[model samples]
Target: MNAFLQEVLTPGSIVQLATLASLIASVNFGVVGTYVVARRITYIAAAIAHSVLAGIGFAVFARAHFGWDWCAPVLGAIVAAVISAIIIGYVSLYLREREDTIISVVWAVGMSAGLLFLYYSPGFNGNLESFLVGSILYIAPADLWIMGALGLVVVLLCLFFYNPLMAVCFDEEFARLRGVNVPLYYMLLLILTSLSVVLLVQLAGIVLAIALIVLPAAAGLHATGKLWHAMCLATVLAMIQSTLGIAWSYTVEIPAGPAIILLSAASYLAVFGWKWWQSLRAASSLPIRS
Candidate 1:
């Protein structure tokens, strides 16, 4: 700490704090990833990430024309994500199968359209690479506040809807019979999930966001059977990864976002292997009937 104070704090104290504030966005993403996996909404996460480009591009256009940063992206992202979710819902309902395949089509088509539109709009592709790959250390404080608020909202709502969600994930038919309003629950879930993608991808970039969300939840799930336990473990794992990734990124030459996610993934794989071995050994110990 003293050494860093002696050396790399050149932009003055405020600038350093401001610079560090950028990383809060990534932290928010890490926390959000848990619920995403818990609900088995990874593809939805991916789709939302892809769809954000159109939202961002449209937002940028709005910003240029009207100069309101927050409102534009909020409206655009909600529109894009809701439309995708609704389409995915209806298509799946009618086809009664292949939801993932249908969602993928939506994801691909949305991104292609976004890219094409961006190609035509001036500066539409500006730093688009960062959105796809993530450059979290560049997130501004204003952006951090926004991301933090969104994360809080999502997590809070998850807590409120915890029971129904658990039922929905475990057995939707049972939940529906129990008067869980499965479709409405899912609608709310998708909305929050889409919002999460927007915020997380903003930090880790869309590409890295998947790792941050999935690896921790998967690892946590391996660690425990209970949903709350899994959620807690995933959050802790995310925080560990986020803090370590930031530290390592500063210490090494690698980008912070991917570095953290890769580290989390490696950790998850090690634990997963251990869990599998444990399960196998336990199964082997069981007596066989003659």
Candidate 2:
């Protein structure tokens, strides 16, 4: 046990660092997943996750270095992501007429901005590559701590504002009628969504954060009807995938990012298939009356 603890003590070791990341990722997914099912807006998560790259690029370019400090990338990413969120939310609300058009532009522009920054940085041809395909095994202890702290904040907020957030995410009109600050909650959700992107980018990178955020949540959500319970189950599922995926990656010598995603995909498919089989069995068991 002492030896095991020592192994995890290092930020570079696969066991210790990845374990922290797995927990951080699980909690992050649980919070984001709640809105995902409530709003039925899976696409929004994907869109924002991709578009966040633009904001991160701005942060990176301003600093002119990736490894200087985690704070730099995080601040830059948050600014870009929140601005993008506002643009996406504003267009979807007021311009409801051409919302899709506006959203597409938001996503495209963010990604393009990142690409341009990558071009300007010397010997940075792989900046885009790093964001797209993360190396899970390379996660730093400081980054894990950052993600864990962010996860705690998100979880606490969700606990305090559960009813308000649910009211807004699931039904804005009802929330407003109940004297809730519906718009405020909506804005808060989007801002936090971007923040989640920042925390996750550190673990799964920009490319895989969406998968980590949405996949396990979707799987558990689709299989269950209860909101809070679904979130719990999703957290467990995500944790399992993250831990197993890391172990598999270490053993197989594959990239941790892809490994985790592939495991998540497999878990989703397995649960989906099992659910479908149960439905079929239940349907067949209902006897027809002549």
Q: Give the top-scoring candidate (lDDT).
A: 2
Show model 2 residue runs off by greater than 4 Å.
1-14, 65-71, 123-127
TM-score of each: 0.82, 0.88
- Candidate 1's displacement at residue 2, Å, is 7.5
Residue-level lDDT of model 2, residues 95-169, one tens digit each, is 778877877787788889877876665645464666777656667677777677877887788768877887787
Judge candidate 2 against the unseen true structure and give its global Cα lDDT, from 0 to 1. 0.75
> RMSD (Cα, Å) of candidate 2?
3.1
Residue by residue across 75-149, what tens digits does model 1's lDDT show? 566577767867766665457678888788888877777666556556454667876777666655566566668
How far does residue 220 in candidate 1 sit from its true spot (Å)? 0.4
Number of the top candidate by TM-score? 2
Off by over 4 Å in 1: 1-35, 65-75, 93-95, 280-290
Least well predicted 10-residue stretch by lDDT in candidate 1: 13-22
Error of 1 at 266 (Å): 0.9
